[model samples]
Target: MEPGNQTHVSDFLLMEVTDDPELKPLLFSLFLSMYMVTILGNLLIILAVSSDPHLHTPMYFFLCNLSLADICLSTTTVPKMLVNIQAQNQHISYTGCIAQVCFVLVFIGFESCLLAVMAYDRYVAICHPLRYTVIMTPWLCVLLILVLLLLSTGDALLHGLVLSQLSFCRDREIPHFFCELDQVIKLACSDTFIYTILIFFVVGLYGVVPLCGVIFSYTQIVSSVLRIPTVGGRYKAFSTCGSHLSVVSLFYGTGFGVYISSAVTDSSRKTAVASMMYIVVPQMMNPFIYSLRNRDMKGAFRKLISRITSL
Candidate 1:
C-alpha cells in the first residue's frame, strides 16, 4: 500500500450525496433552506441572550453556549454538503478532508459535553435554588465551556492524527454524505485495527461519559422536584426542564436510533436514511424545538421584534 503521497489520490468520489439526479435541484433547495434557518435560529438565540438584560443569568449564559455549539455543529457539515452537491464536486483534498472531520468531531463531541454542563446547570438552579448563584457563577460557566472546548479539540486532533496513519489505497469513495470518521476508516486499505480500537475508546469517552453525567444530573433533579410539596412548584420545576429535556431526548433519541438501526439492520438504505434523521434533519429541527417550546426564548424573541419595530 502506498503511503499518503502527492503522487496518488487525484480525487475521491463521494457516492450519492444526493441520489436522484432529477431530485438534486429539490434537495439543494431544501438543504439550502434548512441551512439558512439553522444559522438564523442559532444566531437569534445568541443575540437574544446577549441583548436581553432580563436573561443576564447563568442559565441563559449556558444556553448561549449551546446555541453557539449547535451553530458550529451544523455549519461544519451542512455547508460543505451543500457546496459539494451544488458544485457537483465532492472531492475534498486530503487536508480539507482531515479539517472537516476534525471540526465534525470537535463540535459534536463538544456538544455532548455541553449538554451535560447544561443539565448540571439546570440541576443546580432547580434543586438548590438558594445556592444556584454561588454554584453556577459566571466564571464557573465559562470554565466549563472552556474545558469542553479544550477536550473536544484534543479529541478531534487525535482522530485526525490516527486517520492520517491509515493508507487510503485504491478505494477512496466514501459511502456517506460527510467525512465521518467511521466511514473514512472503512475506506482504509492498511491495517486499521489500532484505529478501530481507538475509535471504541473515544466513542465511549465522548458519548457514554457525557451521557452518564446527564443521567446523573437529571436523576438528582427529579429527586429534588419530587420533594417539592406544592403542585405549582413541581410544575414550575418541570417546566424549566421541559424544553431542554425535549431537545436532549430528540438529539439522543435520533442519534441512538441511527446507531441501533445501523448496527442491527441489514439494509444500507435504512441506515443512510436514519443517518439523515440524526445528522441532517436535526439542524433544522433544533431551532424549531427550542423556539417553539422555550417560553423564555420566545419572549426574548418577541422583545427583539418589538425593539426592531421601535427602531
Candidate 2:
C-alpha cells in the first residue's frame, strides 16, 4: 500500500541489449551509434583541452577530468553489453561482474567530486572575480584534480572490497547491462542489511552531499550576481556558470530519478532505461554541454581551426 514499505526483489534479470529478439539487430546498431558518440565526444574534449594551452584554466581542467570519467564510466558498462548483444550471450562471470560494479561506482564518485570542484571554481570566479585567477591557479587546479583521483580511488575500492565478501548463489542473472552496484549487492548470499546501510551512507556522501555543495555554491553566486549594478553585468556573470549548471541539473536530476524509479518500480526494464539516462546519456552530452554554453571554448575552437587551416 505504501512506497518505502514495498519489498525489494532480491535479484533482477538483466534485460540486456534487447527486449525483442527480432529488434536485436536494430537495437545493436542504435547502441553502437550511441556508444561511439559517447566515446568520441568525450575523447575530443580531452584532446582539445590538452593540446590547447589557451584553454588551460580551472574550468577546463575540471572539464577534462569529467570527460575522462565519462569515458571510463561508459566504457565499463556499454562495451560489455554490446559484446554480449553481438555474440548472443550476455552472461558475465561473477568476478567480471563485480569488477564492473566497482569501476562504475568509482567513476561515478569521481564525476560527482569533480562536479563539486567545478561548482566551487565557478563560485570563486563569480563571487570573487578579483581573486578568481589567483585562487584557481594552475597548480591549485592540478592539486584539486589529484585530490579527486585519490578520493575516487578510495571510494571505488571500498565498495568493491565490501562487495567482494558477498556470496552470490540464489540468482546469477544481473538485470541490466554491465554490473550495477545495487543489482550486484542484491545477489549476495549474506545478509544485505550492512551492505544496504553502507550503500545509503556512501550514496549520501558521494551523491547527496555534493548536491548540497553545488546548491550552496550557486546560492552564493546568485547573491553576488544580484549585487551587480547593471543588468548586463548580472547576466554576464551568470552566463559563466550556465553550462556547468545545466550539466549539473541534468546529471543529478536523472541520477536521482533512477534511484526513485528503482525504488518504486519492480520492473528491470524500467530500471535499465532510467540507468541509461545518467550512466550513458550524460557521457554523450557532456562535451556538447560545455561546447555550446561556454564562450572561451568556442573561441579556442575557432583559433584551433584557424591555425590548422593556415598550416
Give each model a TM-score: 0.93, 0.91
Per-residue lDDT, model 1, residue 110, is 86
- Cα displacement (Å) at residue 204, model 1: 0.9
Q: lDDT tens digits, residues 1-311, model 1?
A: 33453324555655565667788888889978887887888888888878889898887787788788778877777777788888888777777777878998898888788888889989898888999888888898888888889999999998898877767767677766777778777777778887789889999999999889989999999999999999999999999988778878877888899899989998766776677557656656766777787788899999888998899
Please name the candidate that would achieve the greatest TM-score relative to the true structure: 1
Candidate 1 local lDDT, residue 80? 77
RMSD each, Å: 2.4, 4.8
| Candidate 2 structure quality by residue, lDDT tens digits, 1-311 | 12221122333345566757898888888888988998888777777777788887788888988998998988898888778888888777656776788888889988888888899999998888899998999888899888878887788888888877766655567777767888777666677897798889988988988888999999999998999999999989989888999889889888989989999999887888898767888888888888788887777667766876899
- Which pairs clash inside model 2? 13-175, 14-175, 14-176
Clashing pairs in 1: none
The lDDT of each candidate is 0.81, 0.81
